[model samples]
Target: MGDLAAVVAARGVPAQEVMDEYARTLDRLVDPVRHPSLCWLRESGRLGTPDEPDHDFRFGLERVLDGVEALARGASA
Candidate 1:
């Protein structure tokens, strides 16, 4: 992910935008239903079950977006 971010940065994407997109991509990839191992891990307690797995992922993505938004605002300031 860091390598991908570096490549995007090299291509001239704004740093915050790169991070935001990366986080969004991760949100999509982290869907437990899409990955059987993740489901198994969650069921087996290896990953521990969230009250709402999807919501947890969305919350994390929102936090990441918020951080990126904060950085963008700071840059503009």
Candidate 2:
């Protein structure tokens, strides 16, 4: 999600107009059958709210750490 981080860092929370354009683009391009998970996420009404920019990064970081821990454990075993 480095690209996401870069966008958040550069924009610092998108304006309403930007959010509207993003939504329109998603609506136009995101196909439910082709992009089911992305479509679900788009429909969930949780996109474009980057007020706490680090939230997603931290979440992803923790998951990465968890995977590393599991790998370390397996290596030890």
Tens-digit lDDT track of model 1 for 1-77: 34544556588865556556655565566777678776565455433321332565677899999999999999999
Off by over 4 Å in 2: 1-14
lDDT of 2 by residue, 20-65 (tens): 6677799999889999999888788777544365776798899999
- CA lDDT of every candidate: 0.61, 0.75
How far does residue 66 in candidate 1 sit from its true spot (Å)?
Answer: 0.5
Candidate 2: residue 3 Cα off by (Å): 6.1
Clashing pairs in 1: none
Clashes of 1: 0
List TM-score per model, in order. 0.34, 0.65
Q: Report the number of the highest-TM-score candidate.
A: 2
Mark the regions of model 1 whose C-alpha exceeds 4 Å error after superposition.
1-50
Query: How many clashes does the backbone of model 2 have?
Result: 0
RMSD (Å) per prediction = 15.5, 3.6
